[model samples]
Target: MVTDEDKVFKALADASRRQLLDKLRKKNGLTLGELCADHAMSRQAVTKHLVLLEAANLVVTVKQGREKLHYLNPVPINEIYMCWIGQFEQKRLQALHNLKQSLKENDHEQ
Candidate 1:
């Protein structure tokens, strides 16, 4: 019953994983050692989290010479916003625009 988007949401639900994503966002193309430098969790724990993040397509890796550099892939998150949040936001924004137009018309008639 669960979809890939569900997997993305599930991965993002964890604070540790979110922290990893935040770090990548601030500075992309970081190696595993660089990622592990400022974290309370063990390196193995971070590795596990990275696996899940990659499954969700939230993080991508590139082989740069001897190292595998990790980078944040924001496409999944943007898809989530467009598929979920943006639809609801559009309706609310339209209502606000309509209200503003009505108020403008009322002022013009006064």
Candidate 2:
């Protein structure tokens, strides 16, 4: 089963999509034309990338007047960090703590 996390990872795997996300990060809300302005990709290509981003819930659209504004949603990325990356950090921290304790013990015995 393709999970929501899987979708996020897949969407983020592309460099173009990452660039789009970076653009949104720099400026919270942007229209399709704005995103395509300085980018190498065609407007249509950008639209396709945005579709994938939207599917992953990495990008959200808000209709302001006649323009559709795209915004980056940080929640999915934060969830990934908390669930996947944070667990590995805990193990590394524990190892460092153990090493510190071992060094202290050695110093006391010397």
Candidate 3:
């Protein structure tokens, strides 16, 4: 099965592709021309990056008349955060809380 992590990792594998995602995240929906303007690469290069992102389901394109507008699909990224960072954050917060309590106890002993 193609998991959410698989999609996220694939989408993030290329620097240009990640930059494209960042651009879409900021703008939400943008035309191809607007996305191309931010990069030194050719329009073709940007299109290629968009294709990979589309394959990963990280981006979705819609026809807005003659122009195809691209939008970031954030579900996969949210899944990654929930599965990965969410767990780590809980553990980190617990550890920090424990340390704070330990420090308070040490102060009490002094």
Among the numbered candidates, top TM-score falls to 2
Model 1: lDDT equals 0.91
Highest lDDT, which number? 2
Off by over 4 Å in 2: 1-3, 87-110
- The per-prediction CA RMSD against the true structure, in angstroms, equals 9.4, 9.8, 8.8
lDDT (Cα, tens digit) per residue for candidate 3, span 1-110: 44546756877988989888889878888999999995899999898888878878899899988999999998888887787678758888889989999999999999
Q: What is the C-alpha local distance difference test score of candidate 2? A: 0.92
Q: What CA RMSD would candidate 2 show?
A: 9.8
**Candidate ranking (lDDT, best to worst):** 2, 1, 3
lDDT of each: 0.91, 0.92, 0.85
Model 3 clash pairs are none
Instruction: Write the residue-wise lDDT of candidate 2 on 51-83 in tens digits.
Output: 999999999999999999999998889988788
Candidate 1: tens digits of C-alpha lDDT, residues 1-110: 22388889899999999999999999999999999997999999999999999999899999999998999999988987787678768889889989999999999999
